[model samples]
Target chain A: MENFAALIYVISSVLFILALRGLSHPETARQGLNFGIAGMALAIFTTLLLPNVGGYFWIVIAIALGGGIGTVIANKIEMTALPQLMAAFHSLVGLSAVFVAAAAFHNPESFGIGTQDDIHLVSLIEMSIGLAIGAITFTGSLIAWGKLQGTISGKPVTFGGQHALNAALGVLLILLIIILCAGESAVIFWMIALLALSLGVLMIIPIGGADMPVIVSMLNSYSGWAAAGIGFTLHNNLLIITGALVGASGAILS
Target chain B: MSAVLIMAGGAAVSPLVFQLAIFVMAIFVGYYVVWSVTPALHTPLMAVTNAISSVIIVGAVIALGAADASGFSKFLAFLGVTLASVNIFGGFIITRRMLHMFKKKD
Candidate 1:
């Protein structure tokens, strides 16, 4: 059964790769849409075949509600607002990663990692990466969305010692990470997460309005990394592969 | 130190090395292929990437489907799944709508 699921995942992954290739050309691009949807459909179905699935009441509710909202918004949105819409979507991806990270931390035993005392340093690092990157992406994308929406100033906001502040925060985040890796401390973990979120806010606020497209792609890449981090935490190879594929490609596109 | 000794000292480098290899390969593939995309197709190309990245839904689905998921975990997973649904649905439909306009005969 596991092997069957793995086989489906492999085929789905290949289709995803092909779908990406098709996206690269104008003629093949529209034709490629079916492949992507088919790939996603197979992937979702494959997950349902897993032995340990619980009651899916919540999942079903989420899909219906989100699908309804998404369809309405997508059909109504103007082309001029696509950039912001994309940014807002990236924020969703980012927030999704954050939620996944929180879920993992909430219950390590279910993931087959270890008891509360036996957490591996590697997993801790992975979790922290998920936590920090997810938080950063969430807030960063929000700020980008805000800038695009004119709720936030589009001009580059500068102040005295801004670069210095970023540098300080960057260094402090690293220190906190090192400490967290050396030992299990929830307080320090949340602290690092907060700092990372702040870093995201600061990183985008200084970029001018003309560069929002670049920021959009950058956020896209960040969202991928956030997913990759969650993949590491969950010990899911497919997530790592898919997330890395998105992250690297998005970086190149940016 | 020899390679063996160095690996023994490393806590989690192998997974990273493998992951990095995949990342590099994807980057190269994307770089050439995406660049080859004529500027005429940039919008649709962007549309696809946006749609594909929301595969984060996979994680949320798995999380919410876990047998032992607690209340908090389920809630978060539900939120993740919901938002990711928004991304995929909005992204693909919008892409299709835009592409429809291009498909019409003059």
Candidate 2:
């Protein structure tokens, strides 16, 4: 069963890659979307069949509610508002990364990482980095969405020592990660998450609204990296591949 | 130090190393593939990528499926599922809409 699931994942990964390749020309872009949808469906189906997965009642409810909301918003939103919508969607991905990371942290054995007291060193590092990146992406994308929506000022918000403050925070974030890795402390983990959330807001507010497209794309990249980091924790290859693909795509587009 | 470096290099390769190799290569693939996309299709590209990135939902599904998931873990996973579902549906629909607009002119 595991082998079969792995085989399906490999095929789905290929389909995803092809889906991206199809985007090279408008003639095949829709075809690419179809490939992407099929790949996603296959990946999800196979994951559901994994030995580790159990109940599905709540899962169904969650997907139904989310899908309904997404469809309505997509249909009603003005094309002019697509950038902000993109920001909104990126924020969702970011938040999902954080949630999944937290879930895994809370139940390491369920994730096939070791138990709470003996989680693999690599897994610990992966979880911490994933949580941090996810937090940053979540808040950064939110601020970007607000700016694009005109709810926040379009003008650059600058302050004296802004770079210094950001620099200090960055260093502190790294220090916290190191501490978390060395000691495997949950407090340090949450601390990194909170600091990253703040850093995301601080990092984006300084840029003017005109630069929001770039910021949106950059956040898109961060979302992908966040996903990839969590993938490392789960030892999931498809996540790593798809995340890298999105990360690279966002970087290039930005 | 040199001996330690050499020994490390010669040690049996871990699965993480293999996954890292795949990750790095996929980045190159994405770089080339995305660059070939025409300027006119950038918005659709962003939308489509948004759909694909929701692949993270697989992680949520696994979390939800876990037999021993606590209420807190389940809640987190449930939120992950809901949020990712929004991206998957909204992203694809909007991308298709944008692409259709382009096709009308062509």
Candidate 3:
């Protein structure tokens, strides 16, 4: 069963790679979308077969509700509002990581996560990074979405010592991560998450209207990095590859 | 000694290194591929990528549907799937609309 799941994931990953190749060129972009749909469909079907899957009642409902809303938004949204929409989606990716992390935390055994004593430093680091980046992206994208949507000022928000403050917050997060490695510590974990979330907001607030395309692409990279972080935590190779592909492409576009 | 300890944890460390390598290389790959995109197609490109990002819906569905997944966890998972699907559906449909506009230019 495990082998079959892995095989299916591999095929899906290949399709995703081809999809990326197709999306890169205008001539083949439509074809690329087809590959993406096939990859996603295959991945979903294979996951459904997993022994761990349950509670289909809610899953079906969520898909219907979400898919319907998405269809409506797609048809109604203007071309100019696209950057905001992209940022909004990026937030979802970040929030999804947070959800996954919360789930794994509540039920570590299902994810093959061992007790604290047997935990490797690397895994802990990966979880923390994933959580932090995901949190950051979530909030940062929200602020960007707001700016693009005209709910907030489109001008760059700068004040005294902004850069210095961001740097300090970053260094503090590193310290918290080190402290977390000393033992199981939820307090420090939440602290790191909170600080990272703040940094995300602060980072995006300073960029003005003119640099939005760059900001959108940068958030795209951060979103990919967040996904990659989740991939490491889950020990999913395909996720790592896909996340890196998105991250790199977003960076390149920036 | 710490390096040796990291080596002892090579199995865990290796995945991180491998992912980092992929991340770094993908930047180059993405740069070349995305760089070649025409400016006129930028809107469509962004929309297409937006659709692609919905890939997270897969993970969300798994989490929500996973055996014995709790109510709150299921809720979060539900949220993820819904939001991601919105991105996917909205992104692709909009991209198609944008692409249709390109015909006027031609």
Which candidate leads in TM-score?
A: 2
Residue B42's lDDT in candidate 3: 63
All models, RMSD in angstroms: 3.9, 3.5, 4.3
Per-residue lDDT of candidate 2, residues A48-160 (tens digit): 88988878898889889999999999999999999999999999998899899888887787889988767888998888888888889999989999999999998899999
Kindly indicate the candidate among 1 and 3 with the higher DockQ. 1
lDDT for A204 in candidate 3 is 93
lDDT of 1 by residue, B1-106 (tens): 2544666677877755655555555556555656566665666666666777777787788778887778887888889889988888887888787677667732
Mark the regions of model 1 whose C-alpha exceeds 4 Å error after superposition: B1-23, B104-106
- Against the native complex, each candidate's DockQ, computed on alpha carbons, is 0.54, 0.74, 0.44
Cα error, candidate 3, residue A163 (Å): 1.3
Task: Give the top-scoring candidate (DockQ).
Answer: 2
Whole-model lDDT, model 3: 0.73
Candidate 3 lDDT over residue span A75-136, tens digit each: 88776777788788778778767766655544544556655345567777887888888889
Superposed model 2: Cα runs more than 4 Å off: B1-11
lDDT of 1 by residue, A139-228 (tens): 898989999988898999989999999999999988898998777676787788789889989999999888988898888878878877
Decide which is better by lDDT, 2 or 3.
2
Sorted by DockQ (best first), the order is 2, 1, 3
